[model samples]
Target: MSGMINLIKMELFRLVKSKGTYLTILFVVIFSFLLFMMSSSFGEQSKANMLEEDNALYAEITEEEEHIKSGGIGFVGVDFTRDTDIKFETIVHSFLSSGVFLIFCGIFAANTVCNKYKCGFQKNLSTYSNKKWQLTASENIAVLAFTVTEILLIVFILLIISVFYFENFRLGSAANIIKYMGMQAVLYYAFATLIMFIVEVVHSKVAGITVTCLLSMGFGSFFFNKLDEILKLNNFLVTQHTIVYNAKMLPIAFDGELWGTAATVAICSIILYNIFSAFFVSSRDMA
Candidate 1:
């Protein structure tokens, strides 16, 4: 236990000192900012158009009222107002459902794992430690920490930007946001572990990044969906049972069924990937 903890500590320190870590965070921030800005601009334009229509209708109604008072026939149209309130939960859902978050985090995880090999860190660690699985375990924990950090940072930045950009901004239910974010965090960790597993198996940075990027972008799910369409295996869709699919389809309002499905997928992925990663790490020659 002490050795595992020490290994975890070393992994965290290495992650902190790594330049790629900062670069990943920077890229996430920039991408998130740009996304929010574009959404905000589009929202503003929509609201402006709605307000203009509302004003024009109001003016026409006032004129009709005057005409009716003067004993002239005038029909006043029914007033319709659109709800343009942008909720915090909506922003979070949009961000998560886009799959961009997973892509960024997966790339970071792949880079972190592959860099260990490039820098000879994995070789040294394996040389000193008989239990090679501990290194994989430690890397998993560190990646989980980085995933959580990214989640919090993205949420914080979005919330701050929403406050400034949204006139009718609402936070919606606190409980719902918490539940949604909690599940997403689990899925993110699962994704990171899966990336680590892939990196361990491929043992190449380029392959790791390429495969993770494709997977994160939903290519894996797309292929699975197509296979399901072709096979029609008892009407069971494999894509629906995948982590990437669940993460992309997760709703802001928690439904027990969907939430359970997502939790199951994420938990299974985390366990299976970590087991495979540990086995690969232990069985492979680091020399």
Candidate 2:
């Protein structure tokens, strides 16, 4: 335990002092904010369009709502509001907030692991009286810390927009949001470690990062109306968390809780990532 602590502590010091971790977090925050701000004008136009679509959707539902009420499926006097349609704006808000979790974090964390080789730390670690698991734990801790830092910076940028740009931004029942973010932190470490391990094998940061980005982009666009189909197929893509904007309305969905899906995905991905990482790290000579 003491050795693990020392190992993790050393790893944290090394990562933090290097400034790459901090720069990654800062870049995610600032870049996400700027990206959103630049596109917000178009978003305003889109919002108007979405509101019109929402009105049309609700209008289409009014007759069904009244028919259902008359038939005893609902109370007779409950007049449905035309404004109760799906707010695509909320989803847009979420997307603008989460940023490129897959692409950005995947690149950075993978680099952190690969940087070990570049900086000669992997060679130096051979001289330390440390177990492989302890060292893995250290890297894991370092990656996890930066992951959370990156996510919190994201949340901060969201709050900035919510307070300044929008009105009536009542963030109700945001427990889901927090749960989703916590899940992302876990998932990021798992996927990042996996990429890191692969990077070490490939021994090329550019190639490793390029492949990660390609994979993330490919899987990010797989969402559909059939939730089961979407989630089932999405499970294979560990970085699917990058594109998920919001948890579906709960109490009515299976595999819709970002937390649940994220937990399962993270667990499976982490297991696979760690398994290969273990085999490789233990067997490979330092570069």
Candidate 3:
């Protein structure tokens, strides 16, 4: 336990000192904020355009009414008003809707193990007191990294909410949002660790990252959705569960079955990936 704690501490220090991690975090933050700002600006512009059209129509109607009153025989015009239909719900969840958050985080996950290799940290770990301890320490550190990443995400979300919304911005329930974020953190960490395990097994950073991207942002979700649709296997598909579980985080009635499937798949992935990573890490020659 003490060794694991020490490893966690060391890993946190290493991550904090790593420029790549900081750069990735900075990129995600900037991209996410840009997305939010652009969407808000577009929404406001749309509303303004609608109002302008309404005003123009009203002017035309009044002109026609004056002409008719003067017996100038102008055509009749109808009154019209543009109602603001901007859905706060859409704005509040724009981060998820934009797909930027997920993509950036998924890419970060793909690079986790590769970054370690590039820094020669993995090689140093091979010289640890015990080979098993090396893998164990790495696994714990991966968890710590995931935790940090998730916390950063929560912070980003809060910052966005504060900036984009000031009044009437409280999501359905504050408690629910916090709980939902906690659930998302667990899911994201499991997914990231799965990528980490893949990187360890392949021993090729490029290959590992490519596979992670495919699984997280590419054909993996597409094919999984197709399979679920054709085979009625939604409960067992990880990608499907990921989508379904994220939906449950919204301010609406939750689906128990989807939540259950998501929980089951997340737990299974966490267990299976870690076991496989440990086994491969133990057997592989570091020399």
Compared with the true structure, the alpha-carbon lDDT of candidate 2 equals 0.57
RMSD of each predicted structure: 11.4, 9.7, 12.4
lDDT string for model 3 (1-287, tens) is 66566667777776677676777777766765555555556546645665778777556646754433222221111221123233333333333322234444455655666666566666665545364545544545655465557445645664565545644443344444455455555566666666667777776767665664454333454566677677876345444455323422332224476456656666777777778877777776654
Angstrom error at residue 153, model 1: 0.7
Candidate 2 positional error at 227, Å? 19
lDDT of each: 0.77, 0.57, 0.53
TM-score order, best first, reads: 1, 2, 3
Error of 2 at 287 (Å): 4.5
- Error of model 1, residue 207, in angstroms: 1.7
lDDT leader: 1
lDDT of 3 at 134: 53
Cand. 2 TM to true fold: 0.70
